[model samples]
Target: MLLPQALKKGDTIGIITPSSPAPVLFKARYERGLSQLERMGFKIKEGKCSKQTQSYRSASIQERSEEINDFIHDQEVRGIISTIGGMNSNSLLPYLDYAHLKKHPKVIMGYSDVTALLLGIYAKTGLTTFYGPAVVPSFGEYPEMLPKGKEYFEDVIQLRKKAPYVLDVPQEWTEEMLDWNTQDRQKQMVKNTGWKSLREGSATGKLIGGNLNTMSGFMSSAFFPDLEGVILFLEDSFKDIATQERSLSMLKISGVFDKIAGLIIGKHEHFNHLNAPFSIEDLLFEIMGETNIPILTNVDIGHTFPSHVFPIGIKVKLDANQGTIEFLENSVSE
Candidate 1:
């Protein structure tokens, strides 16, 4: 994976809406997020489609694609961040110019629906992208980002050589209502449960995986990377365990599990079960039983609040025994 240069204090981070438009009703929160970035010592450049809206889409596919393409090729922009993830990022895929993106690889960060773009870029151009917080959701929230989220972003942007082996989740996890217009509530802290191991062992491989549903769309596409010797990290939200099992079955049938070195299951907060009696764990163990690789679940880097920023397409070592994931290469250029 090609690591882009680390963003500096005054680096210009471009914000684009490659998916849904910046929520029209949440303009204040969007501004608050930009302010947070400024406070963190970064400059901001708004994309042409940042505020554009068209029938539930951010902008026309051509417009969104051009905005992203322009940002990546612009030498002045140090890094690129999505305002937020939404449906239909795949619509921009056909319009992306892979050759141009390959020539000017930069830090592209976001998760959820943006998984399509991130994974597509990685598979096509070998450019490492981040499955991290978005400007609106993480930086623009009423209470600001959780400490772990902030730490993870700093580590990724600074390209830290040796990040501490900590997977601390915030304790005071809240979905309560608060004023989004005020900075006074931006300092509240939350509690988190640390990491957990599902299978007892150790393994090393490149990190790969993203939003399960988003990934499902890429199942047979050229964008799905070769899963050989990879630690498959997956997570999802709003799906039942049965659907999750079906997706897992798809991966299994696609031979994804056969070539992987290990598995890292991210958070699946709202995964429900229908008539199926088996739990997610039971399903996972049943499907992955033949692989015998290290399996760790609930690592807190997925469709969840206060998540970590993970670099896709980077070589990482997953030590299940120690319950940690260590980067095998520099994630950002010095």
Candidate 2:
């Protein structure tokens, strides 16, 4: 995988609204995130799509693609992050300047709907993008960004910590929902049970996957990375077991489960089971149908508070029995 340089003080992060016009939707929080980024010793370059909005998305596909390509072409921008993720990021794929991005090779990070871009870029350029935080929902949290989230972000992008390191499971976490514009108090914190080994075993491979639901839009495209041997991690927000069944089946039909070296299931943020007769795990096992590979569930990674940043396409060891994942190398170069 192509590694981008580590983020440093004074590094300029280009902010683009690839999907949702979060900057306009939540102006105060958007500015708060920018202020926080500046406080962290980085300069912010707000993109053309940042302040623009058109209901569900920031702009048309051409405009969004232009906004991102502009940043990719900018020599001053050290990194690129989405202001937030939404439904239409998949629409910008064909128009992306992958050849330019491959030559430029800068850090690109975001989650949820931005999965399309993260994995697409990685597949196109072999650049390691991040399944991490975004502006409005992460750094823009009321009062302040969650310390653990900030630490993980810096630890991965800024090299605040070294590798061969085991990710520390947070003592507590929350999926409590609050209106972004009206949030006042911090989210309700609940004790984290940590990772669970649904099946006992271990395997090491390049880490791959993001929001499972988002993957549906682009998984069949050439932009999607080959999951021939991956520690496949997946997560979602507000999805019910039925939707999960469909998505998991999508993976199954694609032969992902059969080819993957291991599996890591992230904690679902506000999962609605719809009072199903089966658990998510049960459904997963049913869909998987007698796979012998190592499997870990409820690993704290995506769409959840204090989530660890997983560098897409980086080497990782998945120890299902120990319920741990250890990074084998630093994701960013010096």
Candidate achieving the largest TM-score: 2
lDDT of 1 by residue, 283-307 (tens): 9889766778888887778666667
- Give per-residue CA lDDT, model 2, range 270-290, as digits (tens): 888899888888888899998
Point out where model 2 deviates above 4 Å.
none
Supply candidate 2's per-residue lDDT for 233.
Answer: 88
lDDT for position 154 in model 2 = 92
| Highest lDDT model number | 2
